[model samples]
Target: MTYSGDVTPGGAPAVRELSGLTVSKLSVGPMDNNAYLLTCRSTGDQVLIDAANEAPRLLELIGGDGLDAVITTHRHMDHWVALEEVVAKTGARALVHADDAEGLPIPAETLTEGDTVPVGDCALEVIHLRGHTPGSIALLYRDPAGTPHLFTGDSLFPGGVGNTDKDPERFAALIDDVERKLFGRLPDDTWFYPGHGKDSTLGAERPALPQWRARGW
Candidate 1:
């Protein structure tokens, strides 16, 4: 079924129609965190990243067909609040980092760096980016046409970085990882779908690395 449009109380789920898939960016809850639904355009198989709040609306989006999997970027409540309900409703397996796995309300398959998750014909490689939380991860997948896409939760944003107030050391490490593992390693053309704001490219954020490091945030 085609998504009608964004629903109220939460910003509309802005659907980005890609080559072989459709990504719906749904802004939910008090923090206005962005949750996404990546579905294969031809097969309709889907994987949801984060649940945030707005359980009712998210349920509507998932509809009757069960979700392939539910991936949590980290363990924060703002990003995972509706996870249990979504998992129960769709019977989808919850996947989270090994460090954050213990904190999830429901059981989840612990994902570590280098593991791959399949959604339809696409494979998402788990990249451990440990700044937002100890187990924070970003999923890197390629579209049918072989274009790279990175789903970075709160670890990295358009111009901002994930809040590191909880653990300064971890945050510092996370920033370094983003630079070395993400920005430095990924292809320049990779599409970055951040957790909070507008989508950016690896090339777009590369130049600002110096500024990010200097700001010390």
Candidate 2:
């Protein structure tokens, strides 16, 4: 499919095919959180990112293919409302950043920056972006034949970074981490999927960084 990244609650997911894996983006819940299901092409092994809501739908989306892990991008309740039920049903390994692990109702394996999450024959590298609840992470998948693809959970979006509650310190920390850890390291062509709404490439959002910073959101 085209992978427009525009998804709505109760709508069909948008699918993106890469060299080694497939990314299926589904929106669930009243909050419109985005849940990503990645399947390894070689092994059909899959991992879900953010089981945000609607346990039955998530389980249905997963189908009989089964799941290997469910990776929560952060501790935000809106981001993991369906986590426990989904994990219980699939027996998938539950994972979250150590800083936000305690916030989850279910116990999860703690992750840190530089951690590698396995998916069948593929792997996703973790990039910790703080200030969006202390343990927000973005997953990076470097396509062997293409550019890097990022799964940014609430830490970044098309117009700006995640909310910092108007706290200058937190805002600064978030902006700094986003700039240094994300924009600086990845190429402009890198396509990123956010927690909600449409996806965008670094090139599309690069010019607005200063604006986002100046506004201090």
10 residues in a row with least lDDT, candidate 2: 1-10
Residue-level error in angstroms, candidate 2, position 4: 0.5
Off by over 4 Å in 1: 1-9, 144-146, 166-168
User: Lowest lDDT 10-mer window, candidate 1?
Assistant: 1-10
Q: What is the C-alpha lDDT of each candidate?
A: 0.83, 0.93
The segments of candidate 2 whose C-alpha lies over 4 angstroms from its true place after superposition are none
Q: What's model 1's TM-score? A: 0.91
Task: Please give, for residues 1-217, the per-residue lDDT of candidate 2 as tens digits.
Answer: 5679999999998998999999999999799999999999999999999999998888888889999999999998998999999988889999999999999999999999999999988899999998988989999998988999999999999999999899999899999999999999999999999999999999999999999999899
Kindly list the per-residue Cα lDDT of model 1 for residues 26-103, writing each as its tens digit: 878677778888887778889999987888888888877669999999998888899999988888889999999987
Clashes (N, CA, C under 3 Å) per candidate: 1, 0
Estimate TM-scores for all models: 0.91, 0.98
